[model samples]
Target: MSPLLLVVAAAGGVGAGLRYLVDRLVTPAAGARFPVGILIVNVSGSFALGVLTGLGAAVAPELSLALGAGLLGGYTTFSTVSVETVLLAERRRWRDAALNLFGTLALTAVAAGLGLLLGSAAA
Candidate 1:
């Protein structure tokens, strides 16, 4: 494998481990219905990805790919969020489902944009 690919592979493992750790730590407090774990990771991932993108011009392409495409990509859980939302709706928790869907969308967008601005300023 290419050196860059190896780096991304390692980063992906790290990201996945971190995701699991964060979920384990936060899920109980987030409650069983809300799925705040996925929400947190997705938003955080978006922010991290935004920072990488904002620093794209100033940073190495390989570093960006490893963290953005590999790390954050693994850390984020869109599929799980979708499944959880669907399950919530199926279980008649319409409010929680809607909140999860809209909340994740709104928060992640804001986080990404904020990260971009901050990262650009820092760069």
Candidate 2:
């Protein structure tokens, strides 16, 4: 195994751990009505990815791969979003379900765009 692979794996583990902690911290405050935790994670992860992408050649390829495919990859949770949206729908909370689904998509895109702009300017 390559050293870069090992680094990415370790980063992924750390990202997953951070995701868990963020969920634990946010869920209670946001309440059971919506899956705010996962939404936040996905959005933030997207933004981070955008920044990494925008940085482009400014950052080393290895570092970019490690942060994007490793850390943010582990941090985001599209699967969880799907499950939660389905659960909300099954529970007959159509508004929350739709919001969770569409809201996440919209928010993440915008966040990523903003991050890209910021990162590109810095670069």
Candidate 3:
């Protein structure tokens, strides 16, 4: 394997591990009514992606690869989010499911914007 791919793989491993730990830690406290763990992960990952993309434009491309492609790519849980949404709908929690779907979109958009704003503001 190439050296660059190795770094990426390591970053992905770390990101996945971190995500699992965080989800486990947060879910028990928040309960089943809300999939708060995945929500937090997705939103945070969105924000980080934004920050990295903004930074890539402002600075180095390599940084974006490390932080955005490596970290956020592994960290985000699109599959899990989709599955959970489906489960909610299957259980006839259509309102909750719809809210989750829309809410994730809205919140991720806001978070990405916020990340860009914050990144641009920083030195």
User: lDDT winner among the candidates?
Assistant: 2
lDDT of 3 by residue, 1-123 (tens): 887777777788878887888788889999988798989998999998877766656756665676677778888888888898999999999998998898999999999998887777762
Q: Sorted on lDDT, highest at the top, how do the candidates line up?
A: 2, 1, 3
Local distance difference test, candidate 3: 0.83
Best by TM-score: 2
Which 10 residues in a row give candidate 1 its minimum summed lDDT?
Answer: 30-39
Give lDDT tens digits, candidate 2, residues 24-79. 89999988788999999999999999998888899999999899999999899889
Worst lDDT run of 10 residues, candidate 2, spans 30-39
Q: Estimate each model's TM-score.
A: 0.94, 0.96, 0.91
Clashes of each: 0, 0, 0
**RMSD of candidate 1 to the true fold?**
1.1
Clash pairs, candidate 1, are none
Whole-structure CA lDDT of model 1:
0.88
Give model 2's clash tally. Answer: 0
Q: Which scores greater on lDDT, model 1 or model 2?
A: 2
Better of 2 and 3 by TM-score: 2
Sort the predicted structures by TM-score, highest score first. Answer: 2, 1, 3
